[model samples]
Target: MPEMLMEVEEEDDVVPNGRVLITGATGLLGRAVYKEFKDNNWHVLGTSYSRLRPRLEILNLLDSSAVNGLVQDFKPHVIVHCAAERRPDIVENQPDSAAMLNVGASENLAKVAAAVGAFLIYISSDYVFDGTNPPYKTDSVPNPLNLYGKTKLEGERVVLQNNDGAAVLRVPVLYGDVEKIEESAVTIMFDKVQHSNKSANMDHWQQRFPTYVKDVASVCLQMAEKKLQDPSLKGIFHWSGNEQMTKYEIACAMADAFNLPCSHLRPITDEPVGATPRPWNPQLDCSRLEALGIGQRTPFRAGIRESLWPFLVEKKWQQTIFH
Candidate 1:
């Protein structure tokens, strides 16, 4: 587990370059964001409801009082809000919980962060846009197709409206350094493909840009640094990987990475039936961040390979009958 610094000692005289408070610090993207700020010599504190540890502070963003108390005590210069219900399918089934986390908690956090004069960065998703468009920009209109996207879009609005200095960063599908394969939509493909004896149907229709979590974390750090230097950095931004791939393509890549046979994997050429309604090819136009030199796109092949290699070794699935 990566080290997430706890509350600073009251007597510590040395002032750090900046202080950052990261919500959902135990999650995939949150973990990366926490590490990025800490590595750059910032006084960083992370919060999580579950996955609690010795150094992390237990925070439930939904509780207005708890949220307010923590932000006031930490007095961070920036608040990176990464906690939310990101799974679309899960959101569809659990609308109430999704709204509470994605909407209510975000709104509360925005209000609290504003009271402390902290710069807020709310992590959003590309699902805000409908699938009919390609290469969506920051100004693109949002028409979320499912409950998850809808709630996230609502979260963006509340955060920006509540906090004048809030910035909404919309990213595409993400995968990196997960504690479990099922933790990420991208990494889970390996699990599906490993069942080589059974036939698996993978979606090859809706195009997706599988962004890396580490890269997103780097961008968050850069944005926070720049925002401190220039307060005008608040607004909407887009950061995504350039490589375009479908689920079938991603599964095939994972199989190739581990030299596993994927003959039983079949590609579904049409929209996935009866599942969550996801946008097709809602590719984000990342020129805004690129122009400012504020992003990075790791090649899909290399990135996914690195992410899944450890799991392969751990599971002892590296050896095959033929090899």
Candidate 2:
């Protein structure tokens, strides 16, 4: 816990904004956003589904009264909507939960945020598009392929309709700052490659463009900052890492980064079998984000090097001490 707290807090930081309300406060990106807002001295209130810690206050987003009352009392200037049933498999199995949490809760938040005259920012996904296209723009029509994507798209619509100043940020698969490497799929591939003795069959069919959590959080904050002046900076915007690689290629890159043996990693050129459909080419064009001068610039290799740091060092230390 001390280490987790320490992982945050860079020497340089931004000045505080007004109050902020963040849902899914304990999630991967949620936690990062919370820490970022707090570090910058913003009055930050975060909500979680489960009782996680002192910082995260558990609240049932389905309970419209609870959500409305929370916003009314907190009176946040900005609301970062991060809570949702994001996993495709979980959403597929529990469609009810997905609809309630993703779509319904989003509508509730947007209504409250609008009533309170607060700027809303909804975190959306790349899966909103079917894999038939190579790159999607902000104005691209969403043709969701799974229940999760459907709910997110619906959530986006409700949010934008409710609050004209609300921003919908569509991001690709995000990875970074994990307690365990397996917490992120990208890092999980790296972990598997590092620990496993035998070669692995790496998927090479679908194209993936993974963004770092910090980058996404940064963009969210920048948009929020812009809202302070230009309240009209609202609409669908996309942010992604500049890198485009297949899973196999990413695994190979990870192998090279960690000095692991790549001979064991065999490229399997086939689509992955799953209960949910995956977008083959989820390459999003960030021209909109770039036009606004808020584009993400973290190169994939540099981002990985930053992410792998203390964790990799700590792992090697544990290995030495235990062995």
Candidate 3:
């Protein structure tokens, strides 16, 4: 299968330009993307349905009229769609709510984005592929195992169908400067282990690429800048870290990072607790992303060092800058 990537001209950091509207501002990736664009000199407007913060507007995505109205008011040159019903359990139990928010909302946003003639960037997932695939490429056929993946795939279709110029970015498990521990998956284990001090079991068989949200944001800004200049750069693009490790390995790394009890960390090889059938290996081939001039990937250890929550507990923010 042929991979799809739109390599646009690179820009200088001393100057950042354009206007970006980010949905789901309260979410991990959304928060990072908002900061990324801002740091790059783009005027960014972020939205959250529940939480209201400085520079963040409240907009109900389920309400098309409200979304469209906001789009008209803001008139952003780029619309980054990060809002979605992401939890697998939630999507499984509440299919209608999932479809309405994940699928329907994206459809509406695509229409509004097109109306404003803005470049639409939809954040997708690696869940679209089954566990059988080790290294999923942009051209890989989607074989979603869960409702969340199905809904996201549907959202991607709606986005691309509505606006051909829209860019679909598929990422893996993410970690960021989290307001809450739940914001980052790896941190979830860290939280559990730190508090428990007893033991933690992680899936050793299942492999994942825990991409850094800041890195995701950085590459996204690059895509947005290129999209703003080149309209032809439209299609499904895969972006993730080169680092590949299982959940067990991730937990161990976090344990060391937080100075938690590493000995308590155990691998679940026989049966993953409450484990749902998922793509065991969804390692993304980022050569396409690299060809676009984005080559360096944040190492797992280094990414954890730059992320937020850990710093609050230990003040390690001075360790590094955004990659």
Candidate 4:
């Protein structure tokens, strides 16, 4: 924990439009969410467990007392739950640990937020739906193919059950300004594209809408603001990038957009063999959130370029080509 967080400022001492608590504040999506809320002049206090930072409150969500104490002390008006065991393969390998965070921790956070009379927004995934269907709606039945999706779906259920005014924002694969290329599932492919001499096989069987984290974070801010004005803005909602592409297509776009090499990349047209099963094309129907006038979708090419440019420049890997 940082010494700044130990100072313990009284909730009433600060006056802002609203106060928001973001979990997993050091992760990809959480960082964006923290920035979005803070830029909007909201009183934002982000939490981190493993990746501790100066501003973030080091919190272990699995600890019930710590969770309650933080929420009670902060007294935030909104809580954005972004922390979870998100990796599908890893979740499959450790279902029990995943459940403790994705399911157990989520339920606890939702309950705590409700007890504090705060509006909670639970970040969910499109993987909750099986790929047999196209564009699943907010109310669509979830048939997760693997343990990760199932755990997220269960988290959604517990959150909604615990708080009537809580919302579940289901999004698809995400990419953003990453601390490392491997931080994002989408940008993780850059390794293959960057290694000009190394041949790699990319998955082209499944369709994915790679959404931007900054856009999702903006939507979360909008939802929080709207919820404050209208308390009835609750329930499951979907927000995803409209541009559809596969991993192979994404790598191709990265090469084109960033002037990276792709000759060594091979596209696998069939479902790629993996330890975990993923949906073929579980595109989310974002109309529910769009209807409420809350959403943003960045084009894939432009978004990826913006996300990776800084990292590329920092590594001095094709600095001349970028400018």
| Candidate No. with top lDDT | 4
RMSD of each: 5.5, 6.8, 8.3, 5.7
Ranking by lDDT: 4, 1, 2, 3
lDDT of 3: 0.81
**Of the pair 2 and 4, which is ahead by lDDT?**
4
Compose the digit string of candidate 3's lDDT tens values, residues 38-149: 8778888999987778868989999989998989998999999998888888788899999999899999999889888999989999999886856878988889988889
Worst 10 residues of 3 by lDDT: 1-10
- Off-target runs (Cα >4 Å) in candidate 3 are 1-16, 195-197, 258-261, 271-274, 308-323
Better of 1 and 3 by TM-score: 1
- Candidate 4 on 1-323: residue-level lDDT in tens? 56566555544345578999999999999999999999888899999999989988999999999999999999999999999999998999899999999999999999999999999999999999998978799988999999999999999999999999999999999999999899989999887887878899999889999999999999999999999999999999999999889899999999888877788999999877755899999999999888889988788889999998875533564555688
Task: Please give, for residues 31-82, the per-residue lDDT of candidate 1 as tens digits.
Answer: 9999998888899999999789768999888889999999999999999999
Q: Say which prediction, candidate 3 or candidate 4, comes out ahead on lDDT.
A: 4
Q: How accurate locally is residue 187 in candidate 1, as Cα lDDT from 0 to 100?
A: 94
* Pairs that clash in candidate 3: 131-279, 131-280
Model 2's lDDT to the true fold? 0.84
Give all TM-scores, in the order shown. Answer: 0.92, 0.89, 0.88, 0.92
Candidate 1 root-mean-square deviation in Å: 5.5
Q: Which candidate is the best by TM-score?
A: 4
